[model samples]
Target: MTAASRPKSVYPLGAKAVRILVADDHLVYRIGIRNLLGSEPGFDVVGEAADGLQAVELYRKLRPDVLLLDLRMPHKNGVEVVRAIRQEHQTARILVVTSYQTEEEVFQVLQAGAQGYVVKDVGRETLIEAIRAVNAGTRWVPPAIQKQFSDRVLRQELTAREIEVLRLLTRGLTNREIANVYGISANTVKNHLNNLMAKLDVADRTEAVSFCLARGIVKPEEI
Candidate 1:
């Protein structure tokens, strides 16, 4: 393709670069992100913050087109920041880049109106595409993040061990049988069952098992 036939951007010909605000607790990380995005051709790092509250304040003052946020900043955290900004400006474009992308974390931030979610390990090209996509009114997330988000929506929250126990429950396993499967004591199995019941909001073991079955939390063949 010729240079004149290259892909387009949201920016008009000879328009300003896309403004960006970055929020991270680590100064070095913040600086690195600033430089990385700043050096790009069509992007500009307009502001940077070391904490969530500062991120919110800077976003308000700068009103950048996009926000690159960290999940674990002090004061408010990335979720709270996303919530605050989207509350004030419904069209706010925010992206969360964090070291950890647990199901809960992805659910919280996306629920709070973040448009893009990615880990810090993403390549520069991927990050740039994510930022551009988000700025252009698109939602962007990695495959693994999408899977985690789907799991959060589809399944009730339970510990890994609790799910293991629940799977065994589907097979008519007694507490002792489940204990033998996991090599845990029967009391530990009982405790896991109790936690699962509470998390599933059920009254008893039978109800808990029924809830899991109804929700397809555990398949029969999986046990």
Candidate 2:
């Protein structure tokens, strides 16, 4: 069959519109998302919250078909809200919508029972697809971010300790200096550096540091 004749995976038109609860600290972001989905044929923007506490309250009251939640918010974080909503409503369809793409942050939300995870920078069509996919009892992760995590999982290059070492390395610290600061042997520091290089796909310390900085593994001020 031709690509144009391929079956679509999303719900059919005129189906039960997916009710969405949007939660974000920024008013502009919330408004933007509301406007975007509001125009879509099968989406109903039911409720909105400015923080995690409000999100939980709205989730209870609105019981929307899907919850688009931010990670960092005042009063409570998205992870806490996800855990809270999941406690009583095991079938809660929550798609973590956040700017954070770090491994630790993603792991925390996933462990808390998020059905779908997507980053904010995803394109409009992909964002809508994510909402529909999550509502349809499937998970959605942006391709780029998925590749990032998949590579990390496959390489198994950086332990938590190695990440720390790379962070310090980005600060332009020498191995001996890092050893002195962390109270570890110089050889241990060197070992951590080697592991970080492998994980970062870099050949040397400078390349590893550059890779980490480029990928947001290190803050600008840390350099």
Indicate the worst ten consecutive residues by lDDT in candidate 2. Answer: 1-10
Colliding pairs, model 1:
none
Judged by lDDT against the true structure, how good is candidate 1?
0.86
Candidate 2 structure quality by residue, lDDT tens digits, 40-101: 66889999999999999999999999999999999999889999999989999999988887
User: How close is each model in CA RMSD to the real structure?
Assistant: 8.4, 7.2
Candidate 1 TM-score, true structure as reference: 0.68
| Clashing pairs in model 2, backbone N/Cα/C closer than 3 A | none
Q: Write the per-residue lDDT of candidate 1 for residues 1-223, one digit (tens) a residue.
A: 4334544344466867889999999998988787676556789898889899999999999999999999998999889999999999999999898998877889999989999998998877789899999999999988877866765665656888999888888788999999998888999999999888877788988898787776667766677
**lDDT (C-alpha, whole model) for all candidates:** 0.86, 0.83
Regions more than 4 Å wrong, model 1: 1-13, 156-169, 172-216, 219-223
Error of 2 at 137 (Å): 0.6
